[model samples]
Target: MYEQISHSLLNEILDELQPNAYERRRDLQHFYTRLGANFYAIHNLFERLYGQRDDFELQMQRLVETLVRKYMHRPRELKDLDIAREKDHNWFLSQKWVGMALYSAGFAGNLRNMAAKTPYFQELGINLVHIMPILKCPVGKSDGGYAVSNFREIDERIGTLEDLQTIADEFGKRDILLVLDVVVNHTSDEHEWAQKAIAGDKKYQDYYYIFDNREIPDMYEQSMPEIFPESSPGNFTWNETMQKWVMTVFHNYQWDLNYSNPAVFIEMIDVILFWINQGADIIRLDAVAFLWKKIGTTCQNEREAHLLLQLMKDCCQVVAPGALFIAEAIVAPVEIIKYFGEDAIIAKECEIAYNATFMALLWDAIATQNCKLLTQGLKSLPGKLERATWLNYVRCHDDIGLGYDDNDIRAAGYDPFAHRQFLIDFYTGSYPGSFASGVPFMRNDKTGDARISGSLASLAGLEKAAQSGNEQEIRIAIDKILLLHNLIMAFGGIPLLYYGDEIGTFNDYSYRDDHDKLGDSRWIHRPTIDWQRVELRKRQGTIEYTLFAALKKMIAIRKETTAFADFNNRHLIDTNNEHLFAFMRFDHNRSSKSVLVVSNFSAEPQTLDLQTLAHEGFGTSGQLIDLYSGQQPVIEEGRLPIQPFHFYWLSEY
Candidate 1:
């Protein structure tokens, strides 16, 4: 927009921006300038959303007013950091980030205790810690802390605000980033807004999608898939007090926030900035795919949802510039990439997104013990934006939904539905001769679509090994865990380890005894980290010692290596061994060396023809070095051999 024209609009909003209401200083001026730059996009969106209302301009005026007020309220230190970050725009794309996702209490008991574990993180080369939501929620009914009751308030059971501040400060001193969840799509029904809504407050009731009857909700449910079928079946829940039905996507307690309402968007935006200002470097926007809903649509990855995110990103840039966003949208591979946004190249959307496709591909490799599906899936994955990257992980607090592409499955010569059904059965031990001991989380009766939930160790075959007490099986299980970890570490993105996976923490069936938790199977994997088990990491022979030491080494290696970057430099290699998954990460400049990562998923020994690698430019001259084994390859004519369930991180000959 023309500077004069923007100035005219600014003149119009000057009363609301309240130039005198602020200190009328350089900071306020700079904020006003940013608002002017973003005003066009924000105005267009806000108006398109609420322009029909008589108070559309009033809401835009208020939103801009809120941004300026928040900027002025922002701490000076954070402001300085934001200024510095604006100067170094791509600062977040650095290779130094290594992440771990864990519950606040499960990891250390409280926020203060989590802060105390800063040294532990530093030791493990972790620079980003995604502490699962520590906000207030109903004790047992909470969806593992996701059913947020308040945005700004910390859960009293976790710790005080002071503890969070201390932890953020501690992490800052060491250059570690703190990542927190902002459950933007929903809030606990007991939240103040929900309570007001229950009391028949028309304004607050509009905060959620409330229908007088089930007619509309049932129509929406015709297309919307059930996230937790066995636990929170169906999308609508009856509210006796209001005598209406409300849409609850995940759980009955988690009332989906009405994004169609501009008020709700503004409030959530405030909540987002609230935490970013409070020292959350990266805010994980939880369940973002379900943010926008339309009656006839599946209500996943709606266009307005993307626009809302784009607006959120623009607004945040005007306020908390240093903060980053990780979109927690686990949709189809194609749909998942859009969370980064088409306008992402201009810093107009999320900085990072969960590489759910790659995650699902890795699991496919685990199940099929072949790279065909993984390779096919990788080929189909849309390239991520240059500025945005992926948060790669094998498991999180949520269940594993096989969100693979049907075309890829068909290309691999398997019936897509049957293959997925097979995976569900294999993981849940319903299929004969399956090694995995997982549970079916949300089994949708209508479509037979079920998500598997279990700890990494249990799902990876360690639990069964421990019961057998077979030395060979236990060793293989440990190798499989480390093997997956190695891929994530070297796969050119921020690798996030689910809290207890480092020490092979198996699923705990104890949650079945708790009334609130028994229904949610994902809780089986959210085990409390045992400090004693952690201590045994020093004792070489124990399971904890072996798994922890191996994982710690992988983390150290990843931190030291510069080749692991998330740019589009990866190439899938055909090793001709079904059990071995091989890929290469190349330097973008093409001058630097590339790393050949070969992961053997099977227990039996697997070999790849060194000749096959020669065609891919691995045989430039001398012997290739296996980073994990630390052994120089016996490349006679450049053919390197590998062991069973083993991997080699090879550089150029």
Candidate 2:
């Protein structure tokens, strides 16, 4: 991108880059200074792809100009943060983080109201908040903001962009991280680019992968999997106005961008930095696995996808050094780990990723009441790089798909295909003895693979038990929820709670009446917070109070323990009690002195052999205090007995 531009303009960009980005000859060189190297590699690739265009270098110059302009516009406070955190780059992989993902409208009705609900985060000890896409999109057709028409503009229904800035500032002052989604994979058919594309402009059409007929699309369909089986049905959509078929992998409205074009990558990089400079401490890269697609493949987790992520990481480091990235890929465990990048050893990609495999495995344990697969699955998970971590959660806004390996299912003594069907049936209450009330989502007719959708409490039997007036069943459900929460908190990473789960919000069947939402079963679990139930918190003898109090107590205790830190160091204890799941969170510096967390999964008392635990460095030289109960556990003759569905964080003298 060599240019004979005036030195005065170059001086302006150099001046801006110098402030936050360290200027060094060799040592302590920032990634920003190395931009020219990235530019060389990218320019060579793009030139090879679009070499005939005379405007290729012109576009390259404009892209660099945009980066310089955005860097200059970045706030002084954020710039200062970049300079300060330049050395200790992996600050995001910390133990203090606890995230909650929510929709701006569903969680609080709007961004302004959501600002007022910061106390909700405080009560739950959450420091990381991921507000699912508040960007503008088409009505009734937006795939929950995945089909974003504009990234900078807030949807008319969700207040203004100023409200989002205010939320970010307030959260920043409180040391809470504000995470926003950057849906770089696609945009709505109504977006300005899409409109230009609809006008039969070849240049605008190049921004997306558009074909005049189904010849190429049908070739892609040969290897690509349909995301939404019942609703969207396919990966390509026909636009009658343009008389072309566009790639819409998730929904018809979301026209997948063509990242093979360098101009598209540069534009998305600007959009990403736009949010980061707007005060976002973290950015969740949504559907990043499908960012780069090629022919003759499923077009997911491709080599080009990894290259794109690397470019993004490099660009972000130049602008917002303090900001972090969480990869949102939910594919199989093997592919999911690649989101961290093979270059993770050098901290080249995302700092955190979703522990979706653990989420799926936990569901497996719930169904089978055994830990064989869960144990084996945990063993199969490769230890993450030093500077990366996992965002552990039980249930999120999306449906839960069984993403485990088929071999793991078979080794657990269940047929892979039949087990998944059983899970969907059990959760949807189609099974005769099922206590759950979930709905089936994305049921693939060819493979019979389907995901289950419901809130944690609803699917854990609380909804049915609460409606049937069965106190014992309800208690058991609450216990199971807490037990699961215990696993997330103790398993050496940040534990994220879905907003409604804290109050046991049930499945809201109200979506069934809405024509737009009726087609998607995931809407069942997208329940708004029941203010009345939330008000019942701290009240005795109520379901809300019981769940809230237990969770609040656990959160308080988790924050106070340094051993709870995540460093990819947790040892599973085969306590020999099938109903009990035991694990030790050992401090890397002090392995001999560690807290032992034991959870009883059954509905009766279970005993742990203290002598067996002592082999893992647990001892009874003095009184053992239970952190959650705030009481000294009674241990006699080297054994600790736990009540049904109870968990203990045992600390010895």
Candidate 3:
């Protein structure tokens, strides 16, 4: 990795480092080792980005100094963790790891309060917790705390930095992983840098994509798609204060950082390392797909963006190698795979990514009462690289967009356009006989595109079944909910359970009353955690108890089954039956001990011919037991019978 120019620059920077007599020399040595290891790639990326600048070496020196200072500021315990993780690099890929994503207030009252709720997570068998964005932001203009005014400080409404540290320390004691969000894509207008830019500070103005007029902005807009057409409308906003146009792809308050500037990249890297030093086990890089902008393109998933991530990761490896990065890019399946980097074997960029296409395909199966599309879509998805895993979840704090490709739709025996319209109609309750009660979000009149927003319980028909007091329908609804959970649990990845999904919490219409959250329907699913409803989880045979107990049992079983670990040991079994989807999970250590998972998407009983899966270890006359329910599946002749909306985890006994 040593190059002449880059190596000479590193030596010069090290010599300029005036190490005091008090442990400063040790700090310098640590920085020197890390810089020497990563400088080759860093220098190449930096030079590629800003080689034309007159002061490239000065900027390179600034970048090195930033890393050294952050490394010095990192606490001893986190540094120790970095070393421990380097020894055991694959710790996160274990099947034993289960994650839960929750808001600070929704899970507990604040950061400090979350410490006392550790037992609550334990009860649900969750060890990885993603505490959604809690950084300080301007009131009401926070964009769910993503529009950060300060990166180092926690919001007063949540808790202080000390509280966050305490919570992280407590989690470590119990062997839990704490994930936090770093809004790397943008900053709030109220942020000091943004404010300085608005105040006509020429140096700070370069931090963002600020232009004197629409001449340049309009050119970029031609290829950029509007993210929030209903509310934000366009990709650029005119700042009256500076009399200039600013790139605001998300919201007017959230200004996109100009990553084309090396200084901006350096500043963001410092912020990322700051959070890792704060004890974040995993840093979720928000909105990474739109980092690098260019003319004549969609300004997404650009090649330079990947290089920036690779450089950031390389620098982080020097300081906090234990802390992993999760790419928060929800783009097409092809683009999503690139976030893991194009490396043939190892992932050079993010270690984890969201499996958004699988999520949308599951919903498609539900709406159509057929697994045709799900199977086709999953088969078309490109295989991910080694050393990288997916964050699989049924729901999060955001709406669900139908991102299925048209070719896959046609292959599944459906018109692409009509099927998408059907899914939207079914979820929004506009289609006849649809059980879902979701509301539409960001409906675009130009493209007729929309997303669904509602709680898992509501979308699964629990709310409707309970409201009508239909006992049979309620049982079916509960079964559907459990079926989805079972899939995510047995699936080859970290199963991220959204808060309130365990006890079948319904949607809260109250978000319509809060002016700050009223515009976004995603708040419907992000309801406050009702302890009273959670209490119902203890009452035997109750709806809440049914879901909580079932999910807890499934989680325990998943942890024990090493076959479920993410080592790319999954093989799909085509069941010919359009209503049934099947896959096999092979244990790398004990190859003979594998599990065959099959689920029926139909309301009526469905059957899968056991002989068809013989190649994948399932034979016509073998003794197979359902691990989730601990019962024998009904096998008549050579076909296994699956109950209405039922799923099975079958293991040979």
As for TM-score, the candidate ahead, 1 or 3, is: 3
Q: What are the root-mean-square deviations of the candidates from the true structure over C-alphas?
A: 2.0, 4.1, 1.6
Models 1 onward score TM values of: 0.96, 0.92, 0.97
Q: lDDT of all the models against the reference?
A: 0.84, 0.81, 0.89
Model 2 Cα displacement at 310 (Å)? 0.8
lDDT of 1 by residue, 1-653 (tens): 44564456656887544456786566666676677777777777776777799887678777877787678788888888888888988777656778899998899998989888998888667889999989999887778888888888999999989999999899889988899999999999989999999999999999999999878988998899777777778899999999999999988888999988889999999889888888888999998888899988889999999989999998998898788999998888889888888864653668888887887788778877777888888888887887788888999898888988899999988999999999999999988888898999878878888888999999988999999998888988887788788888888778988888878899989989988788778889999888988888789799998987787778877665667866667888877766778888887756667888988776566677777876777756765776766778665444565666778788864
What's the true lDDT of residue 454 in model 3?
Answer: 97
For residue 246, model 3's alpha carbon misses the true position, in angstroms, by: 1.0
Residue 340 local lDDT, model 2: 80
Which of the two candidates, 2 or 3, achieves a greater lDDT against the reference?
A: 3
Model 1 lDDT, residue 452, Cα? 89
Order by lDDT, highest first? 3, 1, 2
TM-score of model 3 vs. true structure: 0.97
Residue 441 lDDT (model 2): 89
User: Cα deviation of 629 in candidate 3 (Å)?
Assistant: 2.2
